[model samples]
Target: MNMLHLPRIGITPDINDLPVPETEYVVRQNYADAISKAGGLPFLLPYHEPVGDYLDVIDGLLVTGGLFDIDPALYRQTSRKDYAMKPARTNFERALIEGALSRAIPVVGICNGMQLLAVCLGGELVQDISTEIDGALEHKPDQSASIAHHRIEISGTSRHLQTSAGEVHEVNSVHHQSVLPSDAYQVLAVSPDGVVEALEKKDGGFAVGVQWHPEYGVADIDTIIFETFLSKAREYSQKK
Candidate 1:
């Protein structure tokens, strides 16, 4: 593909606390590799106040998973347990998501990123599925990211069905918090235990969020998801 044809994908990095005074902004290597493999230019976005500045340059927004939780207060819920959170990162991501959606930019969120997206769209999170839902399967499995932990049944009405070869897809789960999408969003997939696994915008625009790390390329569906997002992004870039 021509360099100009490759859509610019702005990816949010994980904020990590270093022993020193400065904080580190980093993304997993596979996240960038996946975007590149999908024929999109991956750009790590730093935490900044002006979301428009970033939105103005990127054709797509990729919200990556992190080792923290979003402030439950953002979803009109109180914290049930103490957990680490980067308020600055959360604030920046919230603004970036809102700006991207307002401008109709393609977005794909993973794990905690998905949770934040749900919150941004007036949805809520399960907080901790194990505690909140009775008999919920273990969402955070103790295994490699490349291994499948569970299978999700894709909804027949979901846009995901277009790329999926079958209604059931084996996915690697790594999130304790799952999305409870708002009325504006449609639940695209769910686990056998009844936990939501994926969601997309009701209007059918590419604003998909998955509670698994698709960048790990755990399954064929993972690549399809990235391809679908990049395809939409390429379209958005061409119009620009």
Candidate 2:
């Protein structure tokens, strides 16, 4: 692809739930700005239409972060009252993710987006990290961008380690639920407390999910994550 032919990257939006008279579909500017800076045409994909339709147009899919959690029922677990969820958003996102994966399009999931990736792939979740895991570090960090909440050891054998350029790197943490150990996806990296911090498909598609929000520009490795995804997306677009 040429410089003028940037891939159209479809970004999933977060449903704003402020209990007002109106509902809004919001995509964080940072997400779009990052994709644009990385050489991809960022488009905000609303939840109004079937995701399959959008799959035929966009070259890549980016699942964004949200304040709500995913319903456990999607993974065959009983729903929890304490857990807050946006069924409409999850339903739409699940469709988009499944469609994108089936088409072999590059997909990147961040924060809750990562959890949705795990659940949609026949895997389970930690649900609540602090209460479920022993000695779990402070996965939830404040709004400060400079804070390095935790460190994740990139698995030497995992493809995602190539983005890190090293064995271990510090990241800004801002999530509670995480992927439980599973075979559906290869655990690419993990927090010191054993929480799954990063993952990629076991069968080797251009699908990757990170527990941290790379759009916020926290660590140096964040650039690699977006650059790699956009590069893969560009190649996919050229093949088409």
Candidate 3:
């Protein structure tokens, strides 16, 4: 795909609902760099009350990792450990993800973004990894991915996984919560510990969610993920 022919990319942004004179709601440059490199216009959307209004303004969506967690109540349980559950953000994230999926929009969800996708699809999450999985990969939210964690086996036939070959990727880890298996979604990849690493909607759609942060890697989202997404967005754009 030509860089000039890329479609607009919708990058979901974090919002602040509190009454404050100053707030920092920004999208990092890495996300844009990846999208631009892959040929896509960058569009960042905040937690607007009526999120649907902006659904048609972009060709694809990337749910970036953030400081908040999905409200456990989304899965029919009260908050455990009182995790930094952002109810409003969680609601918006799910709505946007579902909105995009309904239209067959090429979508990619990072750490928290993947969690949002899971809960939105009626799946549960292990809120605290330290408590559940001993010796779990370290997920430092504020720290940089300066170290290689572990390799993930990419299941064949998965576009996202096949992008990197049969080789296990030496990617960074920086998340505690993980997606629990769901009947509606297939586990595309997993950590050596048997944790759900990535998933795809078996119902049919260009969607995938991985627990790792692709944005922080050497080449964000890899060429295949971005190429596939860009190609889909291009096809969708030309049809319109």
Candidate 4:
């Protein structure tokens, strides 16, 4: 396919503080490379209020992970000191996701992005897995992104089973927070330690979130995720 014909995927950027008292919006190169490899054009979206305008231009949305947390209050939870947040980014992403869902745009959330997605969809998060869940595996394992930290059992009823080769797959985990099981969305996968590893929208419009950083491409399942997301984006583009 021509490069111009590739589905345009809007990727949310991480907001970082600069020493000069300003902020910078940045998207990791891995995300762009992964999107390209999956046959989609990655477009980094800045923090802005006009989410509808951004949604109007992109065929799909990829809410990338970041080293931050969503405010507990957003999900009706008490604040904890261990929680680190970037309110600006969270606010923008929340609006962007709401707008995307309203338009039936495909959305793929990664790590922190997944947490925020849960909150946006009337679900809550386990603020800190280590404290909240007994015997929870070390989720934030300090290792290279390419290294597998643990295994997650894919739910047979999940759409992920269509892309995943088997019921269980090794995945790299890097988040301290995990999504709580809720009726608002379908729990797609879970770690042996019982933490939620992946989820999808029940309404079935291609909304999926995985706790692992699939953009790292550590395993075949990672590639399948990007491919499936881009394929959906392609379908959306054609519909438009």
Question: Each model's C-alpha lDDT?
Answer: 0.86, 0.84, 0.74, 0.88
Model 2 is weakest, by summed lDDT over 10 consecutive residues, at 156-165
**lDDT of candidate 1 over 1-240, digit per residue (tens):** 454778999999977788546878888899999999999999999888688999998999999999899998999999998988889889999999989999999999899888888888889989889898899999998898899989988763666436543478888988888887569588888888888888887664578888988999987779888998999999888878
lDDT of 3: 0.74
Per-residue lDDT tens digits for candidate 3, residues 120-222, read 7778888888788888765554556645576676653474345533546666777888888888677787777767777877665678787876665543335
Alpha-carbon runs more than 4 Å astray in model 4:
1-4, 19-22, 160-166
Clashes of 3: 3
Model 4: per-residue lDDT, tens digit, 98-186? 88888889999999999988998999999899988999899998798789989998863665337442478898989999999999999
Residues 77-123, model 2: lDDT tens digits: 87555888888899998999898888899999998999899887888
**Models sorted by lDDT, best on top:** 4, 1, 2, 3
Better of 1 and 2 by lDDT: 1
Q: After superposition, how far is residue 156 of candidate 4 from its true place, in Å?
A: 4.2
Provide C-alpha RMSD values for all models, in order. Answer: 2.0, 2.1, 2.8, 2.1
Query: Model 2 lDDT vs. the true structure?
Result: 0.84
* Candidate 1 TM-score, true structure as reference: 0.94
> Model 4: how far is 66 from its true place, Å?
0.7
Q: Residue 187 in model 4: shift from native, Å?
A: 0.5
Clashing pairs in 4: none
* Top lDDT prediction, candidate number: 4
Q: Which run of 10 residues does model 1 get worst, by summed lDDT?
A: 156-165
State the displacement of the C-alpha of residue 25, model 4, in Å, after optimal TM-score superposition: 1.4
On TM-score, the stronger of 3 and 4 is 4
